[model samples]
Target: MISQLTHLNWFSVLCAFIPYFILGGLWFTVFFGNPYKTSLGKGNETLPNSPIFIAGPAICCLIITITTAMLIYALNVNTLSGALEFAMVAGIGYLVTNTVNIAINPNIPRPIFYSVISGTYHLVGITIVCIIIVAMK
Candidate 1:
């Protein structure tokens, strides 16, 4: 693990990671904030500014980025097309399916709506991340 970490192209990883985080910010805020909240049965309440609330996602984002970076490296995705293909496969085969399972649970309201919105965001974000990683490589 340490040796692999030493060999990773940090800049490429950063390039891949930043866009995902930024896209998430815009996705859950400007684009689908109200609808997402409504799907969760939440009102227009001010979000807490606590560190866990603020930094938890950031930490999770970094973890996701690291995991994706490792996969890109491991898969030997040296070209833009390969990166995109891998991203699509990962997004659909893993991200979308898992999200759908959760979103479609009986307890969740407007399951399809939430699933579509969130799943699209993941797909787009991962695509952007893969493009950057490949471009930088």
Candidate 2:
């Protein structure tokens, strides 16, 4: 793990993190803004333009990108097929599941709908991160 960290391509990690973070912004605000708000029972209420909303997800994306880069380097996943496989496994197993788990609570009015929206964002975001990490290897 330590060796993998040392050998990790910092450029690729940055490249991947940027898109993942941006995707979260666009996903919630542009693509599914109305639906996402509905799922959260917010209705027509405008989302708070809080720093935590941006900073929190940015931090999460950075950690996810770095971890994905490390795993790609450590596992020697250079091929597109290997990258796709790894992305699917990690995306579905961890990212999507976790999103769904978090949505399944009293706060979210429509847990399944919320899960599909948020979970899919994570799934696609992680896939992009994985591919970038492997391609830059």
Candidate 3:
């Protein structure tokens, strides 16, 4: 349903996706690949095409839905309140994603180094966009 973020623009859809796209790319291609391979207990075998084969699509879909919903109500709704709600929902999503990663890789040390920063950067970006949407009106 929610496919874009533009109505109220509490947080631009493109901006939201930027962090996810970049961080996800790095995660799967670089650092995460190694850990993921080890977790699967397999060698360097190419991934296949299936719902479970590539999980990134599901994640991306989530990001799009959340931001698009935020945008849809931003204009007709209260900007500050909407922004807060958006932030909370998005922050929760970020936390859940990170926590899930840590849960999967229990051995990884606490306090994610670069990945945590990546999420924080995304939060800051969303916050800025929220502020911009409020101020622009």
Candidate 4:
């Protein structure tokens, strides 16, 4: 399957990267950062320092990108139909997320504004990635 994606064009590469970077950037930076930090029992202002701090997000984007690329390549999905499939997939993630939260952060509200914002952006990210691949095809 990796071999399949290797034949993708530069645009496909962008499809992989943009969603990961932009969505993760906005999600972590603006949406979930505050609440997530606090949930970890930290103050509102402490920021992660060190090279790992900066690189961690980049690594996340890379992973998501590669994974998305592979999904498209493997499933033979190609549709510029906007948010449908992505929303469904992300919705599935939310269910899994809720289940995991039940075990880990059971006291934390699923309705926490940051959780919603984080999931929403990630949803849009996957949507855009799927749309881009479909459009290119």
Candidate 5:
């Protein structure tokens, strides 16, 4: 499988991954910033300025993007339609299901709201990445 890595278009993968970083910034700051804070009941708390906080999610986003790209290659999803459908199914089947499991746990606050927002974010993000990768490839 290691040799199979060459089959993937790395530049396309990079292009696909970039939007997640951009969307995340807009989603958590410009677009849903206030709403997300309100949902978390952290309306008064300032956004964390620590490098760890910033870098952590950035790293996670990279990982997620890389994983998505790998999956696309592994599944032989090259067509635009296949990429879109596969990405959506993967998002719902994997990401949303896993998130829902965690969100529904009693320990998680605002379980429903949190799941809706975060899950949707993953779905949208994955879809965007898939479209870019397929189109570019």
Candidate 6:
């Protein structure tokens, strides 16, 4: 594990992290702002402009990027095909499922709608992350 960490390309991880984080910003705000708000039952009401909203997701994306990097190194995934396969597995299995699970609650008025929006964001984000990591490798 330690050896794999040393072998991991830190630069590639950063490169991957940037786009994933950016995608989340765009996904939640620019692209699906109204839909997202509606899903939360906010319906045009301004959501809290708390720093935690940004900081929390940034932290999560960073952790995800680092973990993906480690897994790519440890699993010896070197090809584009391998990266895509890994992305699909990780994206759908972990990210999409978790997003859906979180959305299926009383807080979200439109749980399925919220899940579709958030889950797809994560799926695409993970795909980008995996592709960047593998290409840079």
> Which model scores highest in TM-score?
2
Candidate 5 TM-score, true structure as reference: 0.87
Please give the lDDT score at residue 136 for candidate 2: 88
Query: How would you encode candidate 4's per-residue C-alpha lDDT over 48-91 as one tens digit per residue?
Result: 66888668867765666566666666666666543357535754
lDDT of 3 by residue, 7-87 (tens): 444444444445554655565558566555444443367655576634665465445545544653544434777766665
lDDT tens digits by residue: candidate 1, 17-120: 77788888888879988887777666476555577855776676677677777788777788988988988998888777777888987777788888888888
- Return the TM-score for candidate 6, rounded to 2 decimals: 0.96
Best by lDDT: 6
> For candidate 2, lDDT tens digit of each residue in 1-137?
86788998899999999999999999998999999999999978997898999999999999999988888888889998999999999999999999989998998999999999999999999999998988888
TM-scores of all predicted structures: 0.85, 0.97, 0.42, 0.66, 0.87, 0.96
Q: Each prediction's Cα lDDT score?
A: 0.79, 0.92, 0.51, 0.60, 0.79, 0.94
Cα displacement (angstroms), candidate 6, residue 115, comes to 0.5
Q: What is the Å distance of residue 129 in model 2 from its true position?
A: 0.5
User: Which 10-residue window in model 3 sums to the lowest lDDT?
Assistant: 1-10
Tell me the tens digit of each residue's lDDT in model 5 across 2-107: 5546777888778877788788778888887776776666767877778886678778777777777777777778898898898889899988888787888656
Candidate 4 global TM-score: 0.66
Q: In model 3, which runs have C-alpha deviations exceeding 4 angstroms?
A: 1-6, 49-59, 62-137
RMSD of each: 2.1, 0.8, 6.8, 3.9, 1.8, 1.0
Question: Native-vs-model 2 lDDT?
Answer: 0.92
Judging by lDDT, tell me the better candidate of 2 and 5: 2
Give the lowest summed-lDDT range of ten residues in model 2: 1-10
What's the lDDT of the predicted structure labeled candidate 4?
A: 0.60
